[model samples]
Target: MPQDRTLLYAGRGFEVAHVRLHAPQGPVWSDLYTVASPRVVFPIGRTRLDVRSGDDTWLTDALTAIRFGDATAYRLRPETAAVRHSLVVSGHASVGPTHGASTTGVSVCLMTPQALYRMHAARRQLPDTDGTQAATLVASLVAYLAGAPHQAPWHGAVARARQLLLSEGSGPGTRVLSLDELAEAVSRSPFHLARRFRQQTGLSLHQYRQHLRLASAMERLADGERDLAGLAHDLGYCSQSHLGAVFRQAVGVTLGDARRVLGPAGTGASASARI
Candidate 1:
């Protein structure tokens, strides 16, 4: 696979890089790779990473970020063909202990647009920041994610249903599914699916779908998507203004502001496109 990684800044105890991983033409899974230092990775846009750690495997998309301790080894396969972008921060002092690490010292966190916005702002300042300020900004994000709430476990039909939503949601043309449609796909009654989905994910199907739609919109905007109308339509919004309304409600910024501040300066956008 062809890859491009550019070092954006290197401060005293920390460094930041923008990495782009293109889809491979041959084998689906790439060869194993190891991290020499503790680092946190934020996936952008429609990026989909299927991570293999030890005997376990899981997927990380626009809705998630992953942290790995020194010497951690893993393999990756792209779940989508879109070129994946990620922001990598390494050599931060907060590397001592990270939240939600499994036996391999790799932890996954669910990310929000607000969190991503904060990170993007910090990252955009790296070039002008002194080493101390740089480390502080990057470590702040790590600390914030460390304190976030853990996800409730989802199993059986609920798990499958969640996957279906994520898979369908993380793309250019997102497919909307009603409760009945999702229930049918998961082979469960509508009531059972709805009730169990909320029980496991703490969100109704409608709410979760909305979360995904907004996430997808954020991902695209961060990737320098300027066509509000096109983006809104592709993500199932009624119109550009409708997307702006919900975006402001959820992200606390107008679409134009988000684009100017968060989109494609150097760092990858937040996770949600893959959520």
Candidate 2:
């Protein structure tokens, strides 16, 4: 089940969307620690909108604190057709239910690091915005979100666990995180720890581990530093054979095939394509 990426075309406007997504509820990250969704941004369009949350907070593009009043939308309408990436960071907040191929009509597309860098660099000529300068703010918001990281969390311990994985790679061995060990590190009992971790990350322990492992593997493959055997060891798989099964199943590509995504990477099929 992938997120919706269909571009909606109406009489006077259209939405170009792409981005990877995981809900606040689900085991989406059960495999290994997962990479936060990559950054995907939309260009600010012709109609600037004033978005407000139920809490009375003005919805800015994701960069600001999401309460910066009118500074959330960027007002830039370039004259030509140069492709640009705007960061998005709305919709990720607890919004509402979503289903099928129909667009739920929200904003924010988590972009990959590469996409973020590109968007920031584009700022050199295009200028910067919080979320309000545009006639249309969605693109501006997409820009604001493009370079940001997803740090939203209700509990500190779960975030601490994620930070550890981020700073130290996956685990002791490929597939090697135990609940008791994680609890010890986070200073909570196993049951309480697991519950909080799941609630914060929207994933089970096993799923989080697998997601982390795969993200690590993706990084290694991009660097052209390992074959199946080495990747397995680096990621703690039992052997190259075991690695093959999990790797393909997790990423939808064989180890050999993943190695080729290096140049231009993932076909520039913006994370928007996934949303």
Candidate 3:
């Protein structure tokens, strides 16, 4: 059986897919995106991949990060991995890849292991709708790869507040924290925390939590879960209808439509499934 394609996060402007490919007898080519969207691919193993767009092709190794923009179409051919895990992001700002002297259209940049670890750590700390932090991390990674100046620093208090929020809302049966509680945890007044959080992450704490809830619900639904009421209750929505309203607003599609797109559980591959 193929490995499951898990959508780690998805929101209005960005989405992330965790892809694992099982044993391959030969180089495997997979269609990545049809529409023009900026994408970053981080291969988690010592594998070689050729990213192709039209006649332009770039070669990337496991440790390198590749960025592409204005690509009409793209495909990935992975070599030499029996089981490979890669994190791919779409719809973020496009940065040019570091290219070899001979290769054109793709740039390869060395990413430090520590930086990669911090990126994932920060991602795991963010609520689902808080794509801003994730995007920032990616952009920073790109800048670092391109030998550019880093972005402004995140305030220490706000960073701690974000971690506290993530701890509260990330696990199963976890309850979200009230703004007052979060503020107290970070030693800030609620008003101050809210203001700083918005400035740092581009979303209020409440909005971020809601995005996390909706994202959790969407993952369950995509995994072939039924019982909307149970999902709503588990995720702390007031009611099933409330979940539906929020889902439609955040996803720009009805739950039914999303389910259809996701297909029947255990039978269909996710939209981001590796071919």
Candidate 4:
């Protein structure tokens, strides 16, 4: 079995990963991922996926899109078949999948599967384009995936606050606003805003900001940014060690291990490939 993982796009409240696994009548492959927030998974080929958490298990068909809510630990196993898949992880405020569609806190949606396959093809063709074009395509796709209809009131103050945080938390050099500042902007008391924010979004403001910073760091790392100290400083970390500690805690892997698994950064031509 030969497997590869690539970072396709990372911005603000979300990041997408392209993963390929080639297992031809080989041993079953399983991996554990720490899910801090909601994520959606799309299998590109005819492959079976078994997702488990503790006693809960879900068997999914090929080419189906699955959305999972905040899970502490998740185990993913693939059948004895080759497969290529895309996974998108986003902050809680962006995509929240309710239960009943699948297992608890997991939702299954099937809308425009053809469009998704076309997007996958476009990602394969992205390497041929310039950096600006690739970035734009990625952003567009992310926006589409995150563009689920709002289940809550659109004009609600909490919604506006969430949007403000998401917009400001994207990219590097972001400084999370204070509680007072956020409350003032949203015209709510600090305590009320904090409580409402947490109620609406599964994550607190500080936790959401950390998630964004980590996502940005992952993108820079994939683009061949290797200077840990510089990357830390750019991300507004006090020091490289601080960034390392947070990465290890949140991702369950050290920076060195991630770099080794990702291999060297590829040229734009090698950005996308099949198993």
Best by TM-score: 1
Better of 1 and 2 by TM-score: 1
Off by over 4 Å in 1: 96-100, 127-136, 150-156, 169-175, 195-203, 263-275
Per-residue C-alpha lDDT of model 3 across residues 39-122, encoded as one tens digit per residue: 666655444555666665555544446655545466667655566666677775444444332133444443443444434433
Q: Estimate each model's TM-score.
A: 0.80, 0.43, 0.47, 0.45
Candidate 1 structure quality by residue, lDDT tens digits, 1-275: 56799887786677788888888653288888988888888765556567776765656656677778788888887866668888888887765235555676677766776666656555555544453444565678877767754343224787688778776653355556778998999999999999987775567887677766777776676567888899888887778898899878877777877776656653323222211
User: By the lDDT metric, which is better: model 1 or model 2?
Assistant: 1
- Poorest 10 consecutive residues by lDDT, candidate 3: 266-275
Off by over 4 Å in 2: 1-151, 171-177, 263-275
Model number with the top lDDT: 1
How many residue pairs clash (N, CA or C atoms closer than 3 angstroms) in each of the candidate models, in the order given?
Answer: 4, 59, 4, 0
Q: Model 2, 107-203: lDDT tens per residue?
A: 3222333332233222221222221222133354343543444323223677556544443454334344467877788888889878976664456
Return whichever of 2 and 4 wins on lDDT: 4
Task: Residues 1-275, candidate 4: write the lDDT tens digits.
Answer: 35677776555446666767665653353666666777766545445555666566554433345666777466666654656455454552445464334345555443232234334434444434443445454455444544432122224666567556655643255657788998999999999988976675455778656755665565455445778888788878888899889887776666654444332443344433310
**After aligning candidate 2 to the native by TM-score, how far in Å is the CA of 83 from where it should be?**
26
Superposed on all Cα atoms, the candidates' RMSDs to the truth, in angstroms, are: 5.0, 14.9, 14.9, 17.5
Pairs of colliding residues, candidate 3 = 97-107, 98-107, 98-108, 99-107
Task: Give the runs in model 4 whose Cα sits over 4 Å from its true position.
Answer: 1-155, 169-175, 263-275
Which lDDT value does model 3 have at 247? 75
